[model samples]
Target: MTVINVNESNFKQQVLDADVPVLVDFWAEWCGPCRAMAPVLEDYANDHAGKVVIAKLNVDENPNLAGQYRITSIPALKLFSKGEVAAEVIGARPKAQLEKDLAGHVA
Candidate 1:
């Protein structure tokens, strides 16, 4: 499945209200690290479809979300479970590490 574009408008239903856990990628268009991790996120989304909700929040377009989560850096990966943040990773990392970081939630 393609990644969900989570904004203030549908953030609730897409993330908070979902039955499955959510992987929210907080990124902006100009961030190098964020761009680098895009494909890795997509592959994970495809691999984990139906089991988890993969969402992307553009920090440039949705500053409120970034600020609300206190996302001080680009490429902030946050995992949401049952309406609250379950885990997180900052900066770009290998797919194995990303999966390992979220093993409890996704595996």
Candidate 2:
């Protein structure tokens, strides 16, 4: 699977209503770390495939979601399960570390 781009319009159906856990990466184009985390998320999306859904929501473009989720920084990763946020990672980190952080919810 590939990393999907989510926005205010599709966030409900894609992340909130997903049968599997969804990891939504809140990022912005001006953020260097966000840029660096892109490929890592893509790899994760491919590796996890059906186990989880990886999605990206641009903070710049979707300010409402950023505010709703309280995203104060770039590269904020939130794992959603059953329509609510289950876990969160606040920085750009390695895939192993990220997976470990969200291990409980991912599995």
Candidate 3:
């Protein structure tokens, strides 16, 4: 499964009100780190599709949602559970680290 593309219009319903846990990646086209995290995120999307919902939000195209989320950094990863934010990662960390961080929700 591929990660869902999140935008200002879908932010509320997609992440905030998700029935399952959500991993939202805030990224931008010009951001190197953001680009770097894409493949890892894609792997997670495929590996944990049914278990959790993964989304990618482009900060450049959707600044409204990014600003609302206070995403000052590109490639920021936020975990949402039960309609609220549960955890956050603020850099281009390794996939192993990401998995370790979201272990509780996915596993």
Report lDDT (Cα) of residue 8, candidate 1: 86
Cα error, candidate 2, residue 30 (Å): 0.8
Residue 38 of model 1 has an lDDT of 92
The TM-scores of all predictions, comma-separated, are 0.95, 0.95, 0.91
Candidate 2, residue 102: how far the Cα is off, in Å: 1.2
Which lDDT tens digits does candidate 3 get at residues 21-105? 8899988888898889989988888888787888988888987878878988778999889878888999998889888988877
Candidate 1 global lDDT: 0.90
| Model 2 worst lDDT window (10 residues) | 98-107
Q: Specify the poorest-scoring 10-residue window by lDDT in model 3.
A: 98-107
Q: Taking the tens digit of each residue's C-alpha lDDT, what string does model 1 give over 1-107?
A: 85888998999899989899999999998899999999999888888888887899999898888899999988999999999999999999988888898897885
User: TM-score for model 2?
Assistant: 0.95
TM-score of 3: 0.91
Segments in model 2 whose C-alpha atoms lie over 4 Å from true places: none
How does model 3 fare in lDDT?
0.85
